[model samples]
Target: MKKTMLIIVLSVFALGCKPKQTVANTKLDNKTERLMKGDWLVSSVKYVGSDVFKVTSFNIADAKCFEESMWTLVSNNNTGEVVLNKANCATFESKITWYVNKDGNFVMKFLSEGIKAKHTTSGYVLKVANQTETSFQLIDKAAVGSNTAEIVFQFDKIGN
Candidate 1:
């Protein structure tokens, strides 16, 4: 009985002890520190339902359409921006919320630029049913009837 009681006490203590955070986790934190600043390109975007384009290929032709861009890395890889023109035109400068989902996914949101005009970007999450990739597809978060947008983002490492 005495030995059993001692084992129970030690077990309780062991259960209470928690592991320390390591240097690698710190590095990941640093990597995601900016989470929402810099330039990110769209690689693919799928609308929830009846959508027009998928943006499968990346190219200079697509770069021409960005006005501004931002990125986050906690999840798959979320990015948001405004497209003011096409064929390497110019991206409109606008502030948007870009991040991953609560369940470790990508997500994005675009605020209104005008009263009557629709916000062109929303949703910032990257993930599929059973696969994860280095890239993510931004699609409208709420299908139609929502002001939010869906977009695919390709991140260019800060130096590369």
Candidate 2:
């Protein structure tokens, strides 16, 4: 009886630990990816919430610094680069891999020099909103004392 009970417990535990599977919305992903491939500029960064709330975007610099940053998205390989060259802020550039997930989440992983994106265990996810041929926004949420706030990155296409 004891051996049977132990076996049953282990079986249940194994089943419960199985990973969940999610279906990819390939149609949406492909469409968004195609639309996003090109040069873009971070035209503005806005915070929507209490005026006292402060947030750092992507753990890089203040949200304001992201304004005027240039982004190049190459859809063929899902690779890109971001160039932050705003005045009064440290200049920065990074290679990034990005994709649009099934749920319309924009997933991105920044690759440092000599580091492969697959080896990195973490990345950022933001909801894609108001996407168009000329403009789009990436909205990230932050916890603000039990309330949630939004950090919006507005991107405008730079050129053909």
Measured by lDDT, the strongest candidate is 2
lDDT assessment of candidate 1: 0.40
lDDT of 1 by residue, 15-94 (tens): 88967655311122223324434434443334444455433212222331431343433333333444443444443444
Candidate 1: stretches off by over 4 Å: 1-37, 43-85, 88-93, 113-152, 158-160
Question: Model 2, 32-146: lDDT tens per residue?
Answer: 8889999999998888855577778888888889999999999889999999999999888999999987688888988999999989878888999999999999999987778
TM-score for each predicted model, relative to the true structure: 0.33, 0.84
The root-mean-square deviation over C-alpha atoms between each candidate and the true structure, in angstroms, is 12.8, 3.3
Clashing pairs in 2: none
Give the per-residue Cα lDDT of candidate 1 at 16.
Answer: 84
